[model samples]
Target chain A: MLRIFIAITDNEPGVLDRLASTFRRRGFNIHSLTVSPTLDPAVSRFTLVTDLDDKAARAAKSFLERLVNIHSVADVTGTTPLLRDTVLLRVAATGATQAGLFQIANLFQAEVLDVGADSMVLAGSGSPERIEAFMTALRPYGLLEMGRTGAVAMQRCAAAASLETAVSF
Target chain B: MERPPQPPESASASASARAELPGAQIIWRCLEREGVDVVFGYPGGTILPTYDAMVDAKVRHVLARHEQGATHMADGYARASGRTGVVIATSGPGATNLVTGLATAMMDSVPLVAITGQVPSPLLGTDAFQEVDVTGVTIPITKHNYLVRDPRDIAPALREAFALARSGRPGPVLVDITKDAQTRAAVFDWEAAAPRRHLRHVPPPVPDDLLAKAAAMIQGSRRPLILAGHGITLSGAHRALAAFAEKAGIPVAATLLGLDAFPPGHPLFLGFMGMHGSPWTNLAIQEADLLIALGMRFDDRVTGDPATFAPHARKIHVEIDATEVGKNIPVDLALLGDLKDVLDRLEPRTPSLDTGAWLKDLDGMKALFDAPTWPRVRKGEGMSPVDVLKELQAQAPGAVMVSDVGQHQMWEAQVMRHQRPRTLITSGGLGTMGFALPAAIGAKIACPDAEVWAVAGDGGIQMNSQELMTLTQEGLKIGIAVLNNFNLGMVRQWQTHFYGDRRSASTLTISPDFPMLARAYGLRGALARTPGEAAAAIREARAADASTLIEFQVDPEASVYPLIPPGARIQDMIHEPPSQEAPC
Candidate 1:
């Protein structure tokens, strides 16, 4: 099963390497990982997707949390967290296919970032499933180039809580 | 010299009492504050500044022949003294040499702090001479590591490194300081530079529900066995383990590294268990109904094949590290906390069980399977490794034996009697060779009053034999026992069993005379070619006030018996050949 883990770690040099090394050393298969600065400048948040069973996932969480730089690690897969992946695609399109492409983009709520002489760049952000569907819908136009920010996740919160209070180490 | 005006006592007083010093001086000052009196290291270009500052530092520096030996010494020091061991080295190869030692410490959960000097900040990542990403290379091996480009971060980094090294599930931590960082002066405030309070990884409190579950399991178990591990020694829970075993009437079986955790001759002690472990103890584990695993990760060597390991047993893993609980063999219940604390809380709730029949059965198996009469030596053959270890055990009863990896290590584990925790220091986890001689130096340095002996095989002793000079230079009274069997005994044994005896590179076609080599280093040396001669040499080495090396020429074909073939079940153990004369 795929498990999503949200980790808050110290925003220091080599923190990313350490985090990645932890997963690699334990032979944990990471399907996707997204890391960015959090509201607290001193800390960074990571959204990691790994393929593991329930027990192995718990073991991975325990192992990652043991890193001194990591403040906390939470398995948010069961929480139905809002997961998003931003993808940019440049498709081979001519003026003849522009209208249809715009319509297809509109249907999926994707934005046309640029319109080239013979191609268009489209950007989309949504759940991985939606992203996959959007890519399938646009594949007929001939994708020239593509880039994606692997799935980042956030819990649907009922109230605001500080990072310190949200997780008990 | 005129005394400086004293600051008035106030909340800010400590903050104001700061000393302006270079990063290298700050390193020593922090170590002093951490109560580290000695460090094992070698000097190099990048680390020259620190070496120069050592003249003024109160800490004694033991110069090592190689960086690897230095790290092992620090590791041995940590294991013997129950304190964080410290090692310092230069960048690139120097730092890389510490890798094996660091991994060894990491595997056994030994607390160590490694300080390495990096290329100057400007030259970092530019492929400067002797420049390597030490921290990056050590990331997977170290519990945590720091690379300080700024002089101000030195004190805090060292403080944090020491704290983390000795914290929960202790392991090695590294601090790499750039040359410029070590040279530049900075304000050092011991109080202000203290590691954050939350840096400590405190294990959660033992849950009442888990204790209740464990207690219920114990009450229901008819043939429970306590699998005492290194954690008992690490957590100082030997007493608790014994108390719980006596209270519950469970036989205690120790892992290889866990040999000294429980006294060897205790009635409840079932002997060490794992690959090359005693047959009866392995059989007991296979037959037991409950296995209480404490402070030890179930390494592959211990559980031959996890699928067939303790088939009928419901394991209760009591560990400090949460990751180890279900990493190897799945456990029915996991009690997470310090072993001593967990055992103390669970002891009262544990109902005393009547396991008289179970104990009697185990005793019968032990008597039947463990009885091995010594084979009388033929006139021309050399002594056996067992005979040497037995004589050494009898002569140096209270000595701390630091063993190198391979056949001698296993034989020492099997033949020697360990009465106290931390007495037998060996490379259990990583199984690194050449660990004994240098590690024994570290152990002797850590426990000056205790007798320390380094026991290594012919192949292993040659790995770090140069450290004999360091042993003599430091004037440490360590006994070096080299079982010169003329081959890499363990590998040869494997070839003899599974590889059609195709020795390949296992045989040492040429090797040094270890006794002469020891003498060349200005140390006492002795050679023994028979059991009686080996006993006399061991007695003489014990009686000598100076460090002595005794070379015992043992049978090259002698193999560690009761061996479990790789991936084989414990019950499928291959005992010593029935036609051959038995080992003592």
Candidate 2:
């Protein structure tokens, strides 16, 4: 199985909805998915995960590499230096559910930004894995709204060199 | 024809000073000095002047359809006669076309001199015309290359190129002459260029102690194997190897490129070893206690899993290239020098020991693997490549047999026998297809009295097979046979084993009926469907004494027997169970 980041058209209101529908139609199961807007006004990033085996993973990569409206797709399952994402969730004021959600948020180092008469909103920024795990823990609570940002990765300091440092082809 | 006038003395000092010794005039002088009796080439923009020159020189020029064909022809000729084979091509695309041929020669160490015309020097880097950096492109593939910077350099460069190509570890060399240089008058001074500046050799013997140690290892080892590669061919050490192996009672395995090292019918021969090699050979390799490899790189294809390859044996490697010594597999002992020189020194002091027990063990392995009598070879509807070579072998006996890359070549090497050095030519290292046909033409040109045959597979046959036209026009009497399986059998075999029986793209583009194509090129043709018919066609082709193409269409999916698939230890070979083992 491989984890990949995808760049796709972010303008359409239901782009993520359509993508998930396609996955279900192909009997494909995605382990994780997060979407977010970028500095580019017209595009969005999608960090996705799949449970495919090696051969199937290679075949799937080849297929996705040829899709239209796709800016790029990069697999960063291992050796990716740096990555971060953000998630914000609002939940109703329920006793046991609220207490459990607060404990999970505390575990992930999330900050409780607001407490309203009927709900509370929690915000956190960390790795996509951390964000997704937190979201799964909070799903049972009567969640009012939830939003998560896609993972954006950057090269780590000093170790981020490329082949150009060697020979000039 | 009146001889062209000599260049003025002033032009000698000025060097690049242009004069009017028409390109034709220069060609005549050049061919005369090089003793060039035959050339394989096609006419093009930059070579027009030189072709005109051939008319006046009375030299034979065979017009090949492709530049690659010309290069292979030259390679074949050199292998045939031990003389430098010379090929010609025009500039730009013509020069680029010879890349594969040059690489093929480089890998096998064939002696070839390729002369290519260049655009005028003024337009070289301007993108003015059909201009490629021929020198740069061929740098990795040639023993040496020269771009004539001045008209005066032509004679010396030509002499040097030819000399370098045939000396030491022979290889392809290129002499790129600018259009202006070919046109400009240069003093005709063949005598001025000496071979001293061109000779390549290593003086003196290797340390005597090295041979003594190797001798000790040979005597003590309970089981020993001799692995000889093309280095034996390059060093002209087949006789020494035979002497050494026979005296020591060592079973020998020839890498695909090392095909003719031991006479195929020798009692101690184990045939080819490595990926796609014989099960018997692989099993013997796995079981050997000690191994001495001569002039062969243990590539991944040859040593499926290097760590486990012949795991039971300690290795001793004798090779010319230092980088290859331990690149793939490590060696317990190393001797670097000319193989012939090293072997000759070892012959006298070699200790006599009967590895009877070792031989018995190897025989046991041979029996366990080489016993496959299936795919019953009969005079059915297809030609037997082995029989075709056999018939041709009977006629020529020692007429150098050269093969292009593919399964047919492996079959020919396994079945045919060569009694002399430089008699069996092949592109061993590069394994380039489309080598044999032109090479045979070159061979015939170099050794006119010797019979030459190009044994090729179907896919390889058509790569540069268009040279049949050249054969027809020159009326060169060479034997030609194609093992047409309608597919690239070697890779297809790999696909079967590694890719789960997925034939994939190994199938051919279907072929033009070989007989019609041969006749179209003004040559007699025949087809062999069975072993008997194959032999008969070969006899008939030799009798006709003209260019011929005999096609042998066999079962497309017939797996070459005795294969040791990649990544599998040789000991895991799937050999036939008894009832079919033949004595080596």
Candidate 3:
């Protein structure tokens, strides 16, 4: 099973290296790790995916939090969360197949970014399931090359309780 | 005409408070304020500024031959004196050399503060000469670490480092200060910056329910056993633990590091337990109905297999660190607090129980497995390591024994009759070789009035034998006993049993003349070939005015008896000589 960890850390030169090396040290291979600047430029968010069991996930979460500059580590492995990815798919194309490719692209709500003599590039962004379906459809038309941005996730908020008074412990 | 600068009425009192000094000087001021009088370090280019600052500082700095030795010495000082030991080293290799020692301290939970010099902030990631990420390298091993790129942060970082090293479950902390920061000046206000005591982890209030639960277990236990650990000494709870043992009528079994925490001569003492521990102690643990663990983790050595360990015992762990409660072995209950503080609450609530049958059962096992007396060997015959240790124990009953990890260490732990806590200092958790020689130096420095002995196996003695030069330079009165078995004694023992006596690399075919090496370091040296000679050599070493070394030719095939082979049950002990007794 795949486990996803979202970590917030200070934007520093060695922070990424430190974070990446931590996974390696624990003998967990990072399947897909993506880092991007957050709303606050001083901080960055990292989405890391690894194949780990619940026990290893707990141990890794504790270790990641122990890193010097890591602000927080949340294991979003089993939450009703939003998952997304972006992919650029290039498939062999011609007038004979262009109409069919466009139909498939439209079906997945993808855009045909460019058209070459022999191939065309389709840019797609959606949930992991949608991306997988889009890629699977394009493969039948003779896919040339593909590039994907690994998933980013955020947990859905549950319904709020009564706010007349604060909850007491 | 330089009439000693008049003690300015107000200035003298607050000189350090208002002094604008270089960051390096401020570092020393913080150490001095923390009541640190000694430091062990090896100076290099990056850390030269702090070394230069030391000329005017009041702290005594012992120059270690290697950075590893410096860390071990600092560790020894901490364990012996119950204070945070300080160490300093330069960047890159100098800082890296302290890794082994840092890991050792981390394993044993010793309090140590290590200061390393880093490259200038501008050159940090450029792969500049002698630049390495000391903070990143030590993060996993250290309880906490800091990379101080700014001079203004130096004083506060050092203060925090000291507090972190000493608070809660104490362990090593590293502070990497940049070279540019060290040379820069900062106003070090000692009064304004108060060593961050407020930030220290406050010991939690004892839980009444947990105390009641433990007290109930004690009352209901038929064969109660108390497993004391180094935490008793670290928390100054030896007295409380001993009182609890006596009040509850419980027998106490010590881990290797727990030796002397409870007086070894006490009637309820069951000796140390672990991989190389006594068979009777292990048996007692197996038979115990209630095992009260204080300030000690259930390490793999002590617990052969966590699932099978203490199968009959209801274990209660009293530890400061919550993670250690169920780390290796499951505990029936956990009381998380400082051992001393928890004991203070639990001792009064604990009801004394009548456990005479349990005591009798344990005594019978002990008597059955007691070390049997062997026929005396003559002048030309090689002495057994156990016999040599027995003689040493008889001669120096109260001396502090610092042992290097190996067969001799086990022999010393098994044979020595320790009477008090903090008297037997050895690398228990890490089982570090080459620790004894330098650690004894630090121990002697910490306790000048006490007799200190560095007991090492032939393989271990050679690891840090260079520290003998440090001993001579300091003129410390210490004794060193080298159990010379001409092989890696412990590994050889395992090979003889498990590997069909292949021997392989266990034997040390050619080695240095240890006594001659001792003489080269300006110490009295002697060689003992037989039991009488070994005893005489020990006497001579003890009587010397300066530090001395005694090398004993121990029998090569003499293995630690009543061994529990790896992955074997605690009860399945292979008694000595293989043929003398069957596996119990």
Candidate 4:
């Protein structure tokens, strides 16, 4: 079973390698990993998904936590956390399938970002489950190219958000 | 300014005024401040700056024939004197060569500081000559490591490296500095930059409640066994361990590296406990109900299969490193602190236990399943490895024995009698070959007043035989014993027991005249075919002021018995073929 682990670490040379190598060395196969700068400029955040067993997962967590530069590691797996993956798909857009493609995109709440003579580029971002279904729906449209941002996640917060505070694309 | 009529510029003032010195000089200054009087290393391209700086430093450097030997020598020095060993080498191959030594030190928790000079910062990742990611290479093998890009960071990094190395749960640490960093000048302030006060590792105080819990466990134990390890020696807690054992009337068994931490002939001493440990020691551990594991990680060799290791024991793991408390074996109580401090606190509060029946049972087991013994041999019969080790120990009673891995290592552990702590230095973890000869040189250098012996198997001695030149160059009076069985005896033994006795490639056909080989290094070498000859050869080496190598042509068929087959339980040990009374 896949599990998601989040780590906050110092943005230093070889720190990423140290994190990735910890998983590799422990034989923990990472399925998806997304890394980016956190709000704290000095620290970077990593969201990793692996299929390690319970024992191996605990060992890996402890092992990664022991790295000198790592600040904290949290296993957000099965925590009902908010997990997202973004995908940009460039697919053929002809008269026969254009309507059906647009219908599928609408159903998944995907946006048609670019439209050309015979092709259209669609952008979608949502939970990993929604993204997987969206990708499958777009696969039959003679897909030419695609790019995906690996799963990034965070624990659900209880704070309420106003219209001005919430931003959506 | 003239109000004080200051005493004519003291050395401290002079040091502050003369702050501008090469980075390499700072390295030496830091090492000197850390009380490193001797260093074992070999110089190369990237490390030339440090070697050049050594001219002004007061520290003595022993030039090893190989980098690996240098690391092992430093390790041996640490194990012998309880001081952190220092080794210096260059980048690329020079740095990589120290990997085995670093790993060996890592496995055995030896306090070692390895300094490697890297290619200039500009050429770091450009694949320049003698450029390698020394820090990256040594990350897993070292307790901590630093890659010095700026010259100013040298002193602090070195200081930190030494502190981390010699601190809690001591292990090897590496400091890799760029050649430019070492060659460039940096402002060195001894007091302000190198804060010696902040570097000490003050072990955390043991909690009273935890000690009470541990005490109660000991009080409840009827068959208590103390599994002492290197931590006892590292903490200088041998006396405390012995006192506690006596107070509680618990029998103590030392781990492979822990062999010398307790007196050899004490009634409570049950001998070394592990794979090739005495049959009685293994049985005692298996039968004991309470195991007080001190400073040992319960390595696979000791535990065999974690599931079945000491199946009846309720463990109290007293370790300095918290990560190791329950990493291998479950514990009923964990008293995490410095072994000496913990044992000291426990000793006074602990009441004498009535373990008379347990002790009697252990004594019975000891006599029933004693260490393997060989029949009295006539001349022309090759010497047994145990006999060779016993003869060597008999001759050099106070000598520190540094043994390489394999059959001879086990024999030395089982047969040699140790009266002091830090006396038996070997690669217990990792089990690296070629460790003995170089480590002996280091141990001898550390304690020049004491004799040092390098006990190695024929296959193992050849792994670092080139270090004989280093021994000769240093003019160390170390005795080297090569237990030659004309084969890799341990592997051959495995084949004999598990693989239908097909001795595939384990047998050595091409051979060297070991004594003649020693003579090539300008040292005396001798060959001993019998036990009497082995004794005389050792005596000859002891008499000589220079180093000597005595190659004992040992019995090829002889093997270490009471073996724990790989993946087998500790209780399921295979006894010797000739003495198969009960296979218990």
Which candidate's lDDT is highest? Answer: 1
Candidate 3 per-residue lDDT, tens place, A1-169, comes to: 8898888776766687677777887788898888887767766788888999876777778667655456767887777467788999999998899999999999888999999998999999998889988988888889889899998876665622221112110
Question: Pick by TM-score: which candidate is best?
Answer: 1
Q: Please report the candidate that would top DockQ against the real structure.
A: 1
Worst 10 residues of 3 chain B by lDDT: B371-380
Per-residue lDDT tens digits of candidate 4, residues B1-584? 01121223443565566657788888999889989999999999988999998999999999999999999999999988889999999899999999999999998989999999899887879999978888888888887788887766788778878877887788999999989889877667666554342122334788999999999988888999999998999889999999999988989998998999999989899888877777788889989999999999999899888888888899999988766767788889988789999999999888799999999998788667543452122222467777788788778888788899998888888788888998899999899989999898899989999888899988999999999999888878888999999999899888877887788989987789999999999999999998789888888889988989998998877778768888788777776643322221
From the highest TM-score down, the ranking of the candidates is 1, 4, 3, 2
DockQ of all predictions against the true structure, Cα-based: 0.52, 0.01, 0.12, 0.10
lDDT of 1 at B481: 92
Ranking of all candidate structures by their lDDT, best first: 1, 4, 3, 2
Q: Across residues B1-584, which tens digit of lDDT does each residue of candidate 1 receive?
A: 11122322442445455656888898888999999999999989999999999999999999999999999999999999999999999999999999999999999999999999999987889999999999999998899999998777888889888888887889999999999888887777777677863343577889999999999999999999999889999999999888898899889999988999887888898887998888888899999999999898999999999999999999899998888878889999988888999999989999899999999999789678744542222222567778889889888888898999998898898888888999999999899999999999999999999988899999999889889999989988999999998999899988877887777899998988778899999999999998889988988888888888999999887878778998898888887643343432
After aligning candidate 3 to the native by TM-score, how far in Å is the CA of A37 from where it should be?
Answer: 7.2
Expressed as tens digits, the lDDT of each residue in B1-584 for candidate 3 is: 11122333543456555656788998998999999999999999888899999999999999989999999999999988999999999999999999989999988999999999999877988999998888888867888787887666677778878877888889999999989889977667666455543132334766899899999988889999999998999999999998888888999999989988999889899888977777778988998889999999988888886777889999899988765767678789989888988888898999988989999998798677553432112222367777888899899999999999988888888889778888989998888999999999999999999999999989998888889999988889899999898999899878877887787899999889989999999999899988889888888888779888988888877777657777777777666644422222
TM-score of 3: 0.88
TM-score, chain B, model 1, is 0.95
lDDT of 3 at B50: 93
Q: Candidate 2 has which clashing residue pairs, if any?
A: B73-B438, B77-B442, B77-B443, B381-B529, B382-B529, B382-B530
Model 2 chain A poorest 10 in a row by lDDT: A160-169
| iRMS of candidate 3, Å | 11.0
Each model's lDDT comes to 0.88, 0.72, 0.83, 0.84
What is the DockQ of the complex in model 3? 0.12
Cα lDDT tens digits for candidate 2, B1-584: 11234554655664454344554465567667777777777767776767667777766777788898888887787766766777889889999999998998887777788888888777777875778888777766777677774556677677777777766567888888878777766555566644443332322456889888888888778889999888887777888999989988898998866776778778888777775566667777888889999988897768887878988898888876544567678888888777888888887877877888988887776675443432223333345444555666776777778888777776666566666666778776788888888888888888778777888888888888688988888888888888888889778766765677677889996788988888999988898877777778878887896878888777565454555556666665543212222211
lDDT of 1 by residue, A1-169 (tens): 9899988887778888987887787688789999988877777899999899988788889888888888888888888888999999999999899998999899999999999999999999899999999999999989999999889988888523445454332
